[model samples]
Target: MRIVGDGTRALNFFIDTLLVFLLAYAGFKTWNFYVMYWGYPAYNFGWFFFGILFVYYTFFELVFGRTPAKWFTYSKVVTAKGSRPALWQILVRSLVRLTIVDMFFIPFFGKPLHDKLSGTVLIEI
Candidate 1:
């Protein structure tokens, strides 16, 4: 997690997904642990789950340039050089997190590349 915005990553590594995962887990529990026994079907629901997260973060980040979580943590998502990121940039970053990057090699590669490609960084504000 010691990437460019390492602090932000460290603090939010699990926080961002807490609600999503808890809800997914609770749903599995209510369904008689079917998902768990079935290898946690929610685990494979990449598109649906990440899509929801993307929409949430993208809309908010585009409008506010910072999600509530980032703001609460004294951070803001912005271009690497500290400019406000456009909607597409935010979407790119979120998509990278949702797909190729996070799904495969977390704390591995995508985080920094996302910052670079999206021209964004989660800065400590």
Candidate 2:
């Protein structure tokens, strides 16, 4: 099924990656952690990042259907059924994103694919 959304998910990826990094750096600087990994001073900051992103994406994607970055890319999250996500739905979506299980694989299927597998969507808007 050719999902007619976000023709430039590729471009969104590139832009979003840089934006996340920059935001992370800003977070670090704001916290006065020059030695931190861009605002992550904890040793297990991977988990911290996971946790934070979980909250951010879950909360926003559920309430607003997009993160700040997704908004910048003209994309919004949705359920696979093309409806607004519920709490559990958003939780599941955040889990997929936080784990990076989707981005971790070959064929390089990003958020949209993971959302599809998890019965969610990232629509162009």
Candidate 3:
């Protein structure tokens, strides 16, 4: 399997981020609607977006070994040996993503912090 380049990785990130934002926004609006209906003040749930983001990556990666964005990019996550990663590896990957260090590491290090920590890599299908 060929390793994907930065361009494909960027596209995957953009699409996945968009999907996560949409999910968070939809859920936040639904909650706000109920709060308004109950005569309660609407409050910002900005922080919860990160929680949604975490779950989005974890659930998708665990279940399919890739996100929908990966499907579009024709790439999937695999270990160094080109096998599907373990559950702990996938969990570590999803969690480290929230730290946002991957953005800085990718250009210089040739891989993101999540991939490095999780022992995983994105490979072209």
Q: Tell me the spans in candidate 3 whose CA falls farther than 4 Å from its real position.
A: 39-43
lDDT of each: 0.64, 0.62, 0.89
- lDDT (tens digit, per residue) of candidate 2 on 1-125: 23434455666566655655665556545555644546535434444445456666667777787777777777766666777777887777667665545655425654454565667766676
Minimal lDDT window, size 10, model 3: 39-48
Q: Which pairs of residues collide in candidate 2?
A: 28-39
Candidate 3 structure quality by residue, lDDT tens digits, 1-125: 89999999899999999999999899888888888788766767765578898899989988998999999999999999999889999989988989956778887779999998888989999
Q: Compared to the true structure, candidate 1 yields what TM-score?
A: 0.64
Model 2 segments beyond 4 Å from truth?
1-7, 22-42, 104-113
Task: Compose the digit string of candidate 1's lDDT tens values, residues 3-117.
Answer: 2355667566566677556555554455556655655544444444565677767777889886666766777777766788876888788777665544444356555556666
RMSD for all candidates, in order, please: 6.2, 4.9, 1.7
| TM values, all candidates | 0.64, 0.64, 0.91
Indicate which candidate wins on TM-score: 3
